[model samples]
Target: MKISLVAPAASLFAGVVSAATGPFLTAVDSQTWIIGNEIWNMTQGPKYGVKLYYKDHDCVGNAVGHYVSYNGAANDLAWTSARIVKNGTHSGVPFIDILFTAAEGDMHWVIFSNQHGSYQYFVNRALPTLGEFRTLWRLDNTTFPNGRTVTKDGVLPPLADYLPENKIQDETWRTPDGKGYITKYDWTSWILAQDFYGVYGEETGFGSWYINPGKDYYNGDETKQELMVHRESATGDAVQLNMLHGTHFMVSSSDVFPQGKMWGPWLWYLNDGSRSDALSRSKTEFASWPYPWLEDEPYQTRGSVSGQLTLSDGRPASHAAVFLGDTLPSNKSSLDQGSTYYYTATTDASGHFTIPHVRVGSYGLQAWSGNNSAIEDVSSTFTLPSLTVSKNKETDLGALTWKISEKKKLFQVGSFDRFSYGFAHGGDPWQHGLVSSCPANLTYRVGCSTTKDWCFGQSTKGNWTIKFWNPATANANKSATLIVSLAGYSSGSSSTIWVNDAVVGNLTSGSVGSDGLVTHGLASDPSLYRSATAAGEWRYFEFEVKPGVLKEGKNEVKFQLTRETQWHGFMWDAIKLEW
Candidate 1:
């Protein structure tokens, strides 16, 4: 997909990690780490939850703690953390630990490592035992009228408990040949350990004894407790990986012992080799975990997510948005949005949405109609019981109903409201961010696309990209369409524009197709894009997205152009994603 070439999108997984700022208040309680003579810290706010701080070359004291770092947003969390190390993983860096509260209750430990490909896929090649940790969730519906509605009400059982073919890891880190076992951690608190470890463990080496943090009131007679996470590794594609559980120190009057687990056994993915094949096989093999997005990317994982959302009165919620959200809200949530929803899709006229290729997890299935901001009534924005999806499986939430205030018409999708696309990238200079190539009169914004900034009329292939976030469910019959046009280009010549893999139309003249797509250029207007003499003037072009093309979540649209002649001009007027 050449996906990694583009800049990272906005954060989607809000429940796991929230955006943070620097200068993490000196007033708050926090842990500071030293790495290569640098200080990094995560402020555990007294009022809020957590805030991360690190040494930035640009900050006032060369220490960044005052301003929020979009760099730490959900979408960029892996990249941001991986930049610290040499290699990257699907979730976070290997062995990097973070403490969090579960959606139900009790404190939990989850490490950021796994063989899972990219973000949501799995892979192979064993090395770090840290790679054995992945996440798992279970559906709980006890609160529903049916007595078993979908809900994220419990923890995923250990891999060995459910997957008969899975191998269990109970070996300790220091003692490799020995079976992995949790040991009592009489070490100091996490903050104290950070003080000793520094940012990258440049200080003392013993800090590894208690890496992941734990809670207070453990065993007895202690205000707080420390924990050391432990897990073993398994071989082969059929076996599910084990969760990393912590062993707290049991301190008696004299001797100490290791006992107590943070959570039941969970799972991680060891790629069967590539992500697509692994996720497909993972669902059938890893019976211990739930993976809702197993059916996306037909070319890859073949995981698909399809569901039907209905209104309270039993009417089809055409254009309703069905999305995935974390069962639990992290203390590090957005200060504005207030929810942990990450993935989304719009429903069709029949209230159906199909999004394929999602990773495994128990998610809060939520649906909404009207605009995203229009979700006011509790019924309009309620979570179905937790919906569980497995790899290469279709998670169909059949005809689920919600309470609505009034009946509404089918949602009318439209072009972006002159909004600047947040992301773009490729080999071309003008198409990328070399806005200086634009006319002197036109100012450029990093996230904005404009008329002066269009594809160069060079003969070689070049790519320009713009993306949109779709919150509506997938509509088999009502897929998203594009409203694209250009100005001031070669008069009377055809320039092809490709969306996805198909050439929808030509960018030569303003002509409307039977599908409602119109492609135009100054070739006919003689103005707009520039003077009639401009070499690459294409104006007022549009392409109707065929039904069943677009999906939910972040939709990236690319503009690939080629020059038929030496006509060196074209301006981007409208390259919008609509339906």
Candidate 2:
């Protein structure tokens, strides 16, 4: 079985809705109903207020009973005498009698007695179940006949102001361990007022008292030896008290002060079963003035690549292989099929690839094999400077380049996944085309290539340039260039270069010839560029940028690659960046 706890209905409306009735309603007309000799009614247009009535015992007649008023509205009320009801002799205290009424609006009643004290009752709209009740006065020695004079006025000083500021000295009692100890002292030397801490409790009767020592308490044999006690406070009058049994204190009002009456800032330690071993004296004073405390904010980082790819003819290209390399090629000889070092990827149908959670570092990029050919390839390298990628910020690498292939099939000859490549030539090609296989040095091949002309059949190769800019900052920008040169060729064929969507710039490829070089500028707002050259010999390609395009703060510049054909080998070299 399962049970759920809910707030009491009385607390919901603060006792506004009486359980006996629904709720009260106010009216304009004045009317009255007689409950015994007491006339009860609404006055002054049913406004919210409290009222008092003075009468002798016979005036109300009933000792205990309930009454209902029915003039213009209904009112449920109950009344009882001040007599206390007792339970088991010493088991618990007695209950006090009270009068209660439920009206439409806010109203309350105050009961006072010449011999007893005063108490206030409220029909709280905030606590419907437990009608509000507060004790305003209590019978004590100070307020008794020969005690301090009484005042009906409401003004009163703060409790702390009337209490002594000094700590009292006492005799300490030890526990079994000899470490745990307690001391007892009396406040009669400094206090002449009544005991304010002693308040009324339902179960303990009207005069029951509870004390807080603002420190720890102990229990043990006290008859063995007397322990000197030291005070913890800084000022006022002091008195010495003796500790008995480590639990009780021997205090006498007459022995410590001139006045026979004893008023106290009493101290007591409770040993209730649940808190026996863990219990300590209450720190009530410290609770009044608590200590102070500070708090901090939270922190995160992420990465991604733009979606989309562009061809050399300036059209969106889908399904292109894109690779990301960690380091730039060292020299022209490093752009070989089996010699180059980098990580790679392929673009989706939307020409986009997302690499999430990328670390901050340098990188080289390439794209290939889009239209099932080995003729088109583009490559570029860049560095993401020291950037602190905090939560919510995005670093964008604008674009990367891939060189185009000249063969009928856009890919070189044998380009598998983005990571590795193959060529169809055996001769030492310029763009670092490795010789993987050779049939008597005629049918030369590299990687997984089959034809010598497809791999080493070009004179000058294409070049790609990339310009990176950090839009997050004003002076954040940088540029990198990649050149792929072909050393041999049979004929000149137009090679298609596919730039990833993040690439921005002219889509046309510049021509190259034997022992000649072609250069292109990548210039576009919020974009980088990638391009491929026709099958041929090429040399000395350069990429430069105005300082400050790449920033020091959080920044991103992306370069993606795509191929016109599926199988082809592309080389990358002269990969350099200017600031």
Candidate 3:
């Protein structure tokens, strides 16, 4: 299958060193150092420090903090402390470039300041142990998959040669410009540290340590990462390489996941460019950048937004999630909305919310109240007027109330938190086959069934049913409203609502939802990413239930989807009926 380019944000790496004393180590000159089967030639390109940007969420929005020099505490062991030599700004966003030393063992750390205050960025959790480091090596004279030799710099050779026979299969696609090709390959291997040290490390090797690509340069906490090799022409023409995991190159080698590879679909982008140029480009591409978006980009100014929400009953809508976006509510999330600004925040106990570090722009507001038993009776999404946000300023949206249609409450199932938090088979939705492994008759009955009776997701159509009973006082004469809140969906996913053997309505999940069924994850999980999406957002569908549709007796509301493959399905947040 062909895949498109997905640009996450970029990570900058400054100083990385690999030291070992063995027969495989050799120094060609002051500009070249050959260690084992790998060669590091400093003369090939200019060396530069890595840039670090501090933002609230990952690499999103303008820099919230600035980096000063490192703390350099003497009590810290493992020589994991790197240095920050310089600080600068791009488009008014402050950033720092860090440097490291290879004394005893190469370790690096950087200090940054945000709205909270200045703090040291610990590499491995909050502990002061072995500091992790990353090195960017431009492969020169490497073997290609077609049995050809790549003489220039910035190439890849079937991953590091130390890996055991990987049995990797390569898939290639021609570049859009028709000038080069991008190859996708799978790398499955891990380094046994004891064996690795014996072959590479000097005597008095440390006991336990975790070393991978620097966090400032890449996400050191990702599993299931992959590697993509790009080949460009010798004419110095810019060749774009699309990566799924945002950053170009990343590696994790240690004792993290002993059962198997700690990483999932990890990725590495290989191209020809100076280390300085690569580091600079990474800072520019940090978060909110969609695929195919590169240099000469526009940076959005930072701002904050605050508001208060209350239910129609005048009670505070506590613990609700508020969303701000440039466009009206749709299936598209901020990640898929390309250039469209989106921000999120959660409401406090008093129904007040403040979304900080939002890119300066005009936005419409939407809020979803889920998991709150006190406000579970409320239906439909809450929306407010469009407001403009100014740089370095706060936009206060006065207290607004969410009012649902005046109708008699009939029945409800599950809570609307935009997630399948309490459902059966909900935790770790990625395990086994979410579709085939589900129970044949996934029927959930009200009163008799608990939250554990309902499955989190549905890939099979007409297999799931919600059985509810209508009492003598039930109101079936007036038209009813049936709300279906979505937790996740696949591409081209749609579902039909059936009530008491009568057709109710259908919902088409737009192009911006997670394929959680096939991906084996929830839409909100960071690890749940597709080519065109960063993270999935929650959405709800409201269908008008005719007067005669929902009867005053036993009622069965069935949810069916257009299931064609394992990737087609929908994960529900909640289902409610009001007459």
Maximum-lDDT candidate? 3
Q: How would you encode candidate 3's per-residue C-alpha lDDT over 13-123 as one tens digit per residue?
A: 111113211112122222222211111111110122112111111110121111111112122222223334444443443433333333222222221222111111212
Q: What is the per-residue lDDT of model 1 for residues 369-434, given as tens digits with 9 covering 90 to 100?
A: 432223212222546656665767887766677775452222212211111112121112111112
Candidate-wise lDDT, in order: 0.30, 0.24, 0.40
On TM-score, the leading prediction is: 3
lDDT (tens digit, per residue) of candidate 2 on 120-235: 22222221211111111112211111101011111111122322322112222333344332222211111111112222212222221222221111111111111111121222
* Model 3 / residue 230 / CA error / Å: 18
Weakest 10 consecutive residues of candidate 2 by summed lDDT = 523-532
Q: Is candidate 1 or candidate 3 better by TM-score?
A: 3
Q: What is the RMSD, in Å, between candidate 3 and the native fold over all Cα?
A: 17.8
Off by over 4 Å in 1: 1-302, 328-341, 372-379, 406-579
Whole-model lDDT, model 3: 0.40
Which sections of candidate 3 miss by over 4 Å? 1-302, 327-335, 338-341, 370-377, 491-496, 506-539, 560-564
